[model samples]
Target: MERIAVSALRKTFTLKPGQTVTVDGVTSDRIAVLDGVDLTIDSGEFITVVGPSGSGKSVLLDVIAGLTEATSGVARIDGIEVSKPQTRTAYVFQQYALFPWRTALQNVEYALEVRGVATAERRDKARHFLHLFGLKGFEDRFPSQLSGGMQQRVAIARALSTDPQVLLMDEPFAALDAQTRDILQSELLRIWEQIKTTVVFVTHSIDEAIYLADRVVVMTARPASIKEIVAIDLPRPRDLDIRNSAAFNAYRGRVWESLRDEVGKAQRDWALASSYAN
Candidate 1:
């Protein structure tokens, strides 16, 4: 079954002086952020998007999440066109975006609370996910008290607490240090393995994309489109040792080569944008 269907998505942002089409003339921006991106994601698929900064990777994800509108295109979840945010999708952002006043458990329960889950049931479900994320003891801790990775874990648990059919993550691991990022990545994989949610993940790190995705969708620069959908062909429950394997390097090299020109173009575009702003 198709979990996400995107066709001919083009998005433009109107600036004060001009319009910047972040995604232009692209068909299928919904296939997990690829260049020339016409792709379909099957239900329960774990797909990662790897591109240089400003390659419209996040824009693609936002379109799928319905956070941003596509200027011209179609994004559907479960065969229904998504014109706005749907309850079936949940997004975990890089910044952990938790309520500062809420404790970890309370934060996790926030979504359920909003959905009007009964107090007892919501607390129970929230506690379960918190425990699932290894956040059992930290339930009482505020975001200020937790480390960066822990906060992200809480964010993930919170997103999952809503029982979303599809998970959209925008570089959730980027803010953490190397060791913490590795640990959370491993933990996230474990959670995904158990949950079987269709995941569309965005990241700039080749290693992370290679490690986590069944397929890596590499994208081009501005007005970005899918360049290639590199199947990892690597076995699941991926371990750090895989990063050293020849297969890992092979995939990483392919992504870099595919994105080489796009990276340059994106950098130049940024410089141009800065110049225009000034």
Candidate 2:
């Protein structure tokens, strides 16, 4: 179990090289992406974040992962400020960044290798994770030889093999088909139950958020900030059959109600900007 606290988190991005603006003789070429996010996640919680595309959901995850510096405020993991990438955290991205040359087993073993785990122990750990993720027979398969879902599973196994206290996932199933996405979502929950590791997952689907999370964090349009936090009161060991339940639809509706205006605003903003450009 690991605790996470993001206090007044802010992030701004510089658009271009030497593109400066003057404000009281201060020149800058920056725009705010995330703004003043404040949230706390308890240990072993399954949390999902939802927002419009480009609303800084991924940026927020990166900040918490210690891969990106905040422009203001703080992100802490277990009370320690995240200033840089730490061994206590692992990230799984949508792209499934696996080593093309390495087999699934080898790729999972790589994380342990970097942590200085001995070859035998790491191999055993990697095999266990691969088996847990239901990739038992495909251990030697390369990334190209496996399906997109399998590759992402390997990526997840790689992350979990390190036994990190916190796992940060940025839409890891976004690339898969509808069926694959549904299956992976179930697999993820199963793994979460077994591992009991704190997880911060970002997704665009309202149903997915409500289904997978104990609490869903909804962000406003960019410059993003926490617009609302919705707690899921559903029971554990949930199955896909619950998606058709009235309670499930109610959760989905609640999240959508909170997110509708923000998503519309984001769309309008993009349209306005495009109109200006054209």
Point out the worst 10-residue segment of candidate 2 by lDDT: 18-27
Candidate 2's residue-wise lDDT over 1-278, tens digit each? Answer: 44999999999998788665443466679878898999999999999999998899999999998889999999999899999998989999999999999999999999999989999999999999999999999999999999999999999999999888999999999999999999999999998998899999999988889889999999999989999999999988999888999999999999999999999999987786677566
TM-score of predicted model 1? 0.91
- lDDT against the true structure, per candidate, is 0.86, 0.92
lDDT of 1 by residue, 1-278 (tens): 88898888777655544433333454332323333356699999999998779778888888899888777778889999888888889999999999999999999999999889999999999999999988879999999999999999999999999989999999999999999999998998988998899999999888899899998998877667888899889988888889999989998898888878888888887786688667
Q: What is the TM-score of each candidate against the true structure?
A: 0.91, 0.95
Q: Which window of 10 residues has the lowest lDDT sum in candidate 1?
A: 27-36
Runs in model 1 with CA error above 4 Å? 17-37, 275-278
Clashes of 1: 9
How many clashing pairs per prediction, in order?
9, 0
TM-score of 2: 0.95
Give the CA lDDT, 0 to 100, for residue 78 in model 2: 89
| Residue pairs of candidate 2 with colliding backbone atoms | none
Best by lDDT: 2
